[model samples]
Every structure is written in C-alpha cells, then in structure tokens.
Target chain A: MKPPLWQSIGFYILVGVIVLQALFPFYYAILTSLEDGQALFEVNYLPRALNLANYQAMLSGGVFGKQILNSVFVATVVVILSLFLAVTAAYALSRIRFRGRGLLLLTVLSVSMFPQIAVLSGLFEVIRYFGLFNSLWSLVFSYMIFTLPFTVWVLTTFMRNLPIEIEEAAIMDGASSFTIIRRVFLPLMWPAMVTTGLLAFIHAWNEFLFALTFLSTDSQRTVPVAIALISGRSEFEIPWGNIMAASVIVTLPLVALVLVFQRKIVSGLTAGAVKG
Target chain B: MSKTVQKSRLSRSRTRSAWLFLAPMLLTLAIVAAWPLGRTIWFSFTDASLDLMGEARFVGFRNYLEYVAWGDGEGQYYGLLADARWWRSVWNTILFAVVSVSFETVFGLIIALVLNQQFRGRGLVRAAVLIPWAIPTIVSAKMWAWMLHDQFGIINDMLQTIGLIAEPIAWTASPDTAMVAVLMVDIWKTTPFMALLILAGLQMVPGDIYEAAKLDGVPPWRVFRKITLPLIMPAVLVAVVFRALDALRVFDIVYVLTPNTDATRTMSVFARENLFDYDKFAYGSAASTLLFLVIALITITFIMATRMDLEGKRS
Candidate 1:
C-alpha cells in the first residue's frame, strides 16, 4: 500500500520543516560568530568568511576563559557528588520495603520541583554564614537541591527493574547488603548512572540563578551568567560577536553529547516523567 | 520457630541498612532544601534587610500587607498586596506558562507524529529535534536576542524582504513585542522536550491497532482522533503538567531576553528584584513565599487529581 505521490511529497516537506526549524538557530549563531565588524552589521544568511577572531578575542581577553573553567568545575563536582549520594539512596529506596518509603519518595520528588527563587533569601543567608559567598562552592552546594532528587528518582526507577535472582543468590551466600550492592549491582548500573549523571551535569552547567546571586566576582561566574552579563565598553556597542562565539563554544560540547547519547537521554527523560 | 527467628533477624538488618543508606541524602536535603525553605518563610515575617539581616525585627504580615491611617481611618495600603506591579507579575507568570505550554503541546504533538512515521532518515531528524533542547537556555536567549536585534537583525531583514512589515520592530526593548519574542524563543527551545515526551508515548502504542484500523479503511484523521489521541493523552497530560510547573518558574529566558520590562516580568523576576536590587529583602522573601505556595498548590492539586501512585507497585 504505497502512498500517493502528493502525500509523500507533503510528508517529506513536513520533515524538512521540522529539521530546519530545529537546527536553524544554532546554525545562525555559528554563522554570526564567525563574522566581525561590518560583516556582523550586514545580515548574510550564508557563510561568507572563516574568521576566528571573535573566538580568539573571547578566549584571550577578560575573565571569559576562567568562567568556562568555573562552569566545568561546578558541573563536574555536582555530577560526581549527586551520583554518589543518589546511588546509595536509590539502592535503599528501590530495594527495601519499609514503612513511609512511599512518602519519602514523594518528598524527594517534590523537592526537585521547588522554585529556586523561593529559597534565594534563605540560601543567601546560609551561604554568607558558611563564608561561601563569592566562591564556586556555593553553586556546588545549592545545585544539589535540584540535581539530587531527579538522580534518586531516575536511579530508583532504574534499580527496581534489575533482576532479583542475583540478589537472592548473593543473600544465600551470606553476603552483606553493601557487598551485594558493590559486587552485584554496581556493574549493571553504569548505563543508568551515565544517563542520570549527564542530565545532572547539564542542569548544573546551565544553572543561572544561584550562580548569578551567590558569586559576585567576575571570575567566579559560570558560563551562563557570564554570557548573560557580557557587555561592550559602551552601551551602544554590545558585543554580539564575542557573545555568540562564547555561546557556540559552550554549547558545542552539550550538543555533541546529546547527539551521541540520544537514546540514553531519551530513555532517562522518559523514565523520570512518563513513569511517574 | 528457628526459621522465623532467622527471617526476623535478616529483616531487621535490612531495615537498618536502608536507613543507613538513606541518611546522607536525607541530611543533604535537610541542609539544602528544608532548612533554607524554612528560613525563607521565616524571613517573610520579619524586616530583614540584605545587609543587616542580623539586626532584623519581626513584623507580622507588614511585608505582605500594611495599612497606615492618618485621618478618619482612611489611608493608602502599602505592601505586596497593594502593589499593582506584584499582581501584574503574577498575571504575567500565569499567562506565560499557559500560553507557552499550550503552544509547545500542539507543536510537540505535530512533530512527534511526523517523527513517528517510518522514514529513511528518522534518526537524523530526531537528532536534529534534540538540538534546540540541548542548547542552554541562556545561550538560546542570547542567540535569539541577536537575531531579533532591531537594526541589523536577520529576523527584521527577512520580514522586510517578505513584506511582512514596513518598520523594523525592537523585539526585546519594546513592550508590545517583548513577551512575543520571549514566547517564540521558549517555544522553540521547549517544543523538543514536549515532542520527545510525546514521542515516548507514541512509541508505547502498539502497531497492530493501527494496522487493524487501516484494514477497515478508516480515514487517517479519524484514526488519529479516535485511537492515537486517546492512547497518548495520559503521557501528554503528564508532560503538560510537568512543563506548566516548569514554566511557572521561568526565569532564565525572561531575565535574559527582556530585562526590566513590566510586560514580561514574571513572579520570579519580581521577587529577585526586591530581594537584591530594590533593597527590600523581607518584602522579596514574602514574594518568594507566595510563589512557592502557588506552585505547591498546583502540584498538590495535580497529584490528587491524577492519583499518581507514589509507590512503584502499579507500574
């Protein structure tokens, strides 16, 4: 049952539109990044010149390079800490049947949905009390509020689906719960960990509010905040070229990771949302 | 009797270890989430300034609402309740959430249906759809801001070339078009997430039903309306609520794209402004408290409405 020629053509056109709409903005950003001075002022959709001056300027000037490193450090520490805590907690939540377990899971899930602004005043006080203001550690500490719950939820969902027979066999051999988790579940949980860790890393990398409020210094700012605060010397001359170049540099890694782990990302997202 | 005792001992040890495993996470949540949230609420009841938070005095409901009477028991009201801008921000947040989520759902469904088709380069198309979602929100906001630039923007250039308008519009600066520009960027970024969620739902629908409908000569539109839509409604509804809750707290895009515009100032922005910029820390805490209450009310209502199983037994 072949479709009619017109219908097939219409379908292909729809596909073309979807692909174009999805990819056009990033393409335009990349194009705009390569142009400088008069080239930027003129709107040319096509690639005209291959210039790396904007990238060079952004990397070599100001605190932009340090900001990129700040984002990397914050996101990396956040992912590692959240994954370690979430795995142990997920093992308990998924494997053990205890009283108030359902309520506990619900509490964790609700915490993730908290509006960041809601905690701003208090978290600010906490940061000041701990003397973490104007430091990257403030971001690492605050990001856990959003990252921890989803990691636990997704990993709990993933851990529950593992085979129970292996655990039962391990139990018969008189192995402790820690040993079973270490020897039995650790190897099998790598894919789930990777998926959740990547999502956590992305969340921490892209977080703007805490980064904006907690870190007042120019060098301590993350990439998102730094990009938002990027400005030229004069109000009239906004540095769009350097901004786009920095934007492209930070986004390329995330785009590559998403493309490569497309399947795992999809599964991880669905596991968190659709399953709930 | 010996077997029963052994079982009891094993179960006791399991429960103990479970608590041990959960202790670290629960403590972290208490320190980061629960304690901070409690202090935020507490600050709302006091006159805490940003610089002199320690010397703050308690003021019951003054930050939320206060009345000063000078003559004949008649005067103006002061506080968040009386401020028209606060109400406006609440309205803006709701409107942004409702409008953006609705557009994302519709566009998401269409893209999901298109991608669900058997095509030659389906993987490539799917990967392309993920691009917008993969880009950071602030980066996308900057990219769109550049493209929507009033003077040298490509959007204005293309619109002129297409004869859509006579004069170039200042998208982010102008009050009339600020919200529109924000919505455009938001829809572009979030539609992929909605589509992916719906795509997951679409995949769950068995193919045999579609085959059966095809054998019966059912029209494609009817098949979609009658079969496909109903089956995926649960997933779509869940996604909608999720996205709505997310949209209610929208800060990054609105902050980056249209700053200091009354037309697009969300509750989050308004709260943050008072917290730091306006030097009204207690008042800002009050605003933050209300925002949390709104989201919490919506979430509770949603959970009760759906009767979502907290325990993983049913699924």
Candidate 2:
C-alpha cells in the first residue's frame, strides 16, 4: 500500500519542513555563536566560521560560570527533594489502601496545573518570610510547587502497576512497610524513578518565571536568567554571539538527555498528562 | 489467633506509616502552594503596596474597584476596566491562546498522522522535532528574536529573497506584526508537545477498526473522519485544553520576545508588572485572582466535559 509517487514526495517535503522548523532556530544560534563581531550582522544560512571565542568569552568573563553552577545545584536539589517526597507519598497512595486516595491524587494533579503567576506575589511573601530571597534555596522551595505533584502522580501510576506478591512476601517475613519499600520496592522502581527524576530535572532546569523573580543578583541567577539578561557593555549593544553561545552550552545537556532517554521521557510525560 | 494478631499489627502500622509518609509532602505543599494561594486571595482585598507591606489596611472592594472599575458618574470609569492597555492585553492573551492552540492542534494532528505511518527514518525525524521542546523557552525566544531581527534577521532575508515582503520588516517592533511574531515562536516551540500527545492518542486506536473500515472500501478521508477522528478526539481535546491553559498564562515567550508592547502583553505579564514594577501589590493580586478564576473555570469545564464523555462512553 505505497502512496502514489506525488503524494510520497509531498509527504517527504512536509516531513522535511517539520524537521527544519524544529531544528533551525538552534541551528541558527550555533551559526551565530560561531561568528564573532562583524560576522554576526550578516544573514548567513550556513556557518561561515567555526569560532569558539564567544563560548570562551562567556565562560572566562563575568558571572555566567557561577550562574551555570547555580542552575545545576538548584536543579539537582529540586530533583532530589521532589523524588524523595513524591516516592513516599506515592507509596502511601498506591499500595496502602486508604480513604480519599482518588480525590487526593486528583488534587495533586490539579496543583501542578496552577499558573505560576497566580502564586507569584504570595510566593514572594513566603520566600521573604523564610529569609530565602536571593538564595538558591528559594528556587528549591518554589520549584516543589510544580515538581512534587507531577512526580507524585507519575510515581503513583507506576507503583500501582507493580505486583502485590512481593510486598506480601516481605510482610510474611515480618518486614515493615518501610522496610519493604526501601529494600524490595525501590529496586523494582528504578526505571520509574529515573524517568520521573529526569523529567523533574528538566522542568527545574527550564523554569524561567520563578527563577527570574526569586533571584535578583548576578551571583544568584540561574542559567536561564543569566542567558536572558546577557547584555553587552554598552546600552545599545546586545552581544548576540555571546548569548547564543551560552544558550547552546545550556541546551546541550537537555538535548543529550532527551536523545538518550527518548522513550522514558515520552512515557513519563504521557503517564503524568494522560492520566489527568 | 497469632496470624490474625500479626495481620492486625501490620495493618495498623501500615496506616501509621502511610500517614507519616504523606505528612511532610502535604505540609510542604500547604506552606508552598496552598498558603501562598490563600494569601494572594487575601491580598486582593487590601491596598498593599511593596513599599508599605505591613501597613496594608483592609480596604474592602477598593483594590477590586481600582482593578476593575472605580469612577464618579458621568460615564467615567477608572481602573483596569478603564485601562485600554489592560483590555488590549486581555484580548492579546485570548487571541494568542485561541489562534496558537488551534494551529498547534491542526499541525500536531497532521504531524502525528505522518509519524504514525510506518516509514524509514521515523525515529530520526521524531528526535529532530523534539529539539524545540527540549530547549528552554527563553532560549528559543532569544533564538527566534535574532532570526526575526529587522535589519539582519535571516527570516527577513529569506522573505525578502522570496519576494514575500518588499522590505525587511521590524517584526517584534511593529505592533501589527508583534502578535504574529510571538505566535510563530510559540507555535514552533509547542507544536512538538501537541504532536507527542496526539501521537500517544493515535497509538491507542485499534488496528482492527481501521481494517474493517478499509474492508468496506471507505475513502481515506472518510476513514479518517469517521474512525480516526472520533477515536482520537478525547486525546486531542485533552491536548487542546492543556495547551489553552498554558497559553492563557503565557509569560516567558511573550515577555522575552516582545517586552513592554501592549500588543503582546498577556494577563500574566500585566499582573506581573503591577506587582513588581509598579509596586501595586494588591492591584496585582486582584488581577492574579481574576486570572486564577479564569483558569479554574476552564479547568472545571474541561473536567466536567471529560467526566461526561467518559460516562457517555460507558453507557
């Protein structure tokens, strides 16, 4: 059942267009980053040079180096905290028969759907109250508002599918529920944990509004904010090449994660979303 | 008797641990999400400004009046209701959401359909499209901004080369094309998300149904309309609702690409300005509360519709 020749050609052309639309921006960014100074002003489809000076300059100068470190530290802490809380709660909801579990899970899902702006002012108050303003801990605290619900939901879905016999066997051996979860269940839940953790990491990595609001100083800014506020020394200058360089550097890890764990990422997304 | 006693102990401890396990997470959420949300609602009723945080006196309906409408008679209205910029932002948000979500759905369906077919290099193409989704929104906005630069942007160059425009257009700078520029970036970044969701939906359709339709010698479009569309409608609806909700609160792309422009300011951006820049905390809270209500209404409607659809399917 091959398509007609013309239709096949058309299909390929459409596919080509989709791919180009998806990749062109980043591709163009790379091309721009490679061109320094006067080369950036020209509209070139292909790379005219392969210069690493912008990347070198971004890393060597200013606080971008610290910003990348802050992003990593914050994102890592978020993933750890979110996975820890979500796993325990997911266990309670999934394995232990409990009243109001369904309603509770639905509530958790709805919390993730909250628009960030809706919580901004109050969150600002909360951050100020905790004395966490301009600190990485503020991001760690604020990101949970989003990361927890999603991890909890996805992990609950995963835990619900595991066989009951293992837990029962552990119980027959007089093992505690906590013991069973730590020793037996955690071993089986690695794939789910990995998928959920990675998704949480990516969410924390890409979050902009919260990052932008909570942190003010150059030393406290995350990679996204750093890239956003990347400006030239002069008021009129934008320094496009340096911005593109920083963008590529920040995006490489995310692209690698997506490529390597493509299937797991997709499953985690559908599991978290479709179940809603 | 011993077995039953052991089982009882296990059940009791399990309940205890369950509560124990849920406590920290629930407390964290209460402090982080629920409490802040409650405070936002409370703040909406006051005249709190950032400069005088603790001095906020309860001014019943004052903030609301100023946010919505507060003026003497003689056809005078002040507040957001009187503010043309606020209305323009609201319009821009709705327009952006509706148009972008509609296009994303159509393109997502087409992309999903294409990707659903068994073909060579499918995996490569799938991975390629995900690049946009993986990049940060700010990064993508910056990238698109460069590409849409009036004087030196490649997009303008290509358009000019192709004779689509007689001159290089200042896309983000011009009010007429600002919304269009934002939509292009949003649609580009988000269509992959819609496609992935719709692809998941497409995978759920049983092959036998399609086989039966084909056996009847149904035209392809008829098969698609009758079988594919109906079966995938729920997933598509879910994707649409999600995208629409997201679009309604869109801040990053718009804020990054077309900052300070009335033509592209969204509800979120409008609220943020009052809260942060203008130091009108209570006014911002009112705007935020309104935004929250709008999102909540849409979500409730979606949930009700989904529930009814499920019950209808059951019947």
Best by DockQ: 1
In terms of lDDT, the poorest run of 10 residues in model 2 chain A is A267-276
Candidate 2 docking quality: incorrect, acceptable, medium or high: medium
Off by over 4 Å in 2: A233-236, B1-9, B66-76, B308-315
Candidate 2 lDDT at B132 equals: 90
Clashing pairs in 2: none
Candidate 1 lDDT at A23 equals 91
Collision count of model 1 = 0
Per-residue alpha-carbon lDDT of candidate 2 for residues B1-315, written as tens digits (9 for 90 to 100): 998998788788888889899999999998888988988888888888876766778887766554432455334445655667777888999999999999999999999998998778998899888889899999999999999999889999999899999989999999999999999999999999999999999999999998898788899999999889999998898899989999999999998999998889999999999999988899888888889989999988877677622111121
- Give residue B240's lDDT in candidate 1 (0 to 100): 99
Predicted model with the maximum TM-score: 1
Docking model 1 quality class: high
Predictions' DockQ, in order: 0.86, 0.63
Residue range B172-232, candidate 1, lDDT tens digits: 9999999999999999999999999999999999999999999999999999999999999
Off by over 4 Å in 1: none
